[model samples]
Target: MALPFARVVFLCRWGAKRWGIATAEARRGITFKLEEKTAHNSLALFRDDTGVKYGLVGLEPTKLAVNAERFLEWAVVLADTAVTSGRHYWEVTVQRSQQFRIGVADVDVSRDSCIGADDRSWVFTYAQRKWHTMSANEKAPIEGIGQPEKVGPLLEYEAHRLSLVDVSRLALVHTLQTDFRGPVVPAFALWDGELLTHLGLEVPEGL
Candidate 1:
């Protein structure tokens, strides 16, 4: 049987700042539709399955500039391990490489069937109740002006601090090719598989 999961989607804005992170508005949900026949036919219908699969409560961006290697190392460590009830609950780690402009790592939930799906499309839900209990601490780093002499140190610091929490998935929302530069912000969420019944962002009325 497929384990129950919740998906959380965040609407983000990119500013001219060299670096920063922003959190989504509370009580609002990101929605997507499973228009693809393959995805629709495979799962039960009549349900709004495509939404934020994970519960996204907040977002954090770091200002320190660092190389890709160091940035990933810290991110993996932060996501893989968690401190719960003054004790360690599970061990999470990055199982892949830092080759992509945006990097990702998984927090192993002990059950092979726990987290379903590949890519950033799906993720396992963790600390559901705790997520609600914890208040949002949305923090974005200070923006960099012009190009810094070096981004290595800044990136390294950001990666280190980022590693202290539990994030289900990370997304490189905008890239150089996409006409976005500096402060490559990534968004993370706590996913439950059930949210993907819908997909994509909604258009404003009378678009």
Candidate 2:
């Protein structure tokens, strides 16, 4: 069951100004200045009673889910903390679900759709020994890194930079530089079958 979004985020690009669309940064050529905004700095689920199982166990992942009877087919969960400014990094241990997505999404992205399958999200996933990145309807192959045991995401909100690090090898796997606007939260999805618990939630400080 998908619930109504608590808020709606409008994405905008920046370069000579704020909220300018049309790949503003491209027109200005990769030189983007930092814009400041106040937003929550901690990460957690919107609520504990999500359609899927969620809670905290010690310091591992502050948030966790395994899915319930109703959402056994597919489900999505967003972190309570929304990043609006500054540079931040975090990691997730993809546990049970053989098919899963890890990345960020707008507050109002389609609840029924999987992350990365839509334009508002930037994510990475693995299934059947293959890895890919999702951007809207496009799924592109990402080589040199496959099925990372732990994924480290480095987000520079003001700079509009997103990098997915292969924590297993301490190497950079994928990177995206965009001016995505809105209250973005860490997004997760599980598919293929029921996923068991074991994913960690604690935000890793850095490499």
Top lDDT model: 2
lDDT of 2 by residue, 4-81 (tens): 322323343322222222122232211111111211111122222221222212112213232110112125555444
Residues 1-207, model 1: lDDT tens digits? 233222222233323331222113312222223221111111222344232222122122232222221121111111211111111111122212111011112222111121222221121222312111111222122222221111110011122212122222222111111111122222123222222111122212221
Q: Please identify model 1 stretches exceeding 4 Å from their true place.
A: 1-29, 48-122, 125-207
Instruction: Point out where model 2 deviates above 4 Å.
Output: 1-74, 192-207
The number of the candidate with the highest TM-score is 2
Determine which window of 10 residues in candidate 1 has minimal summed lDDT.
Answer: 147-156
Total residue pair clashes for candidate 2: 3
TM-score for all models, in order of appearance: 0.17, 0.58
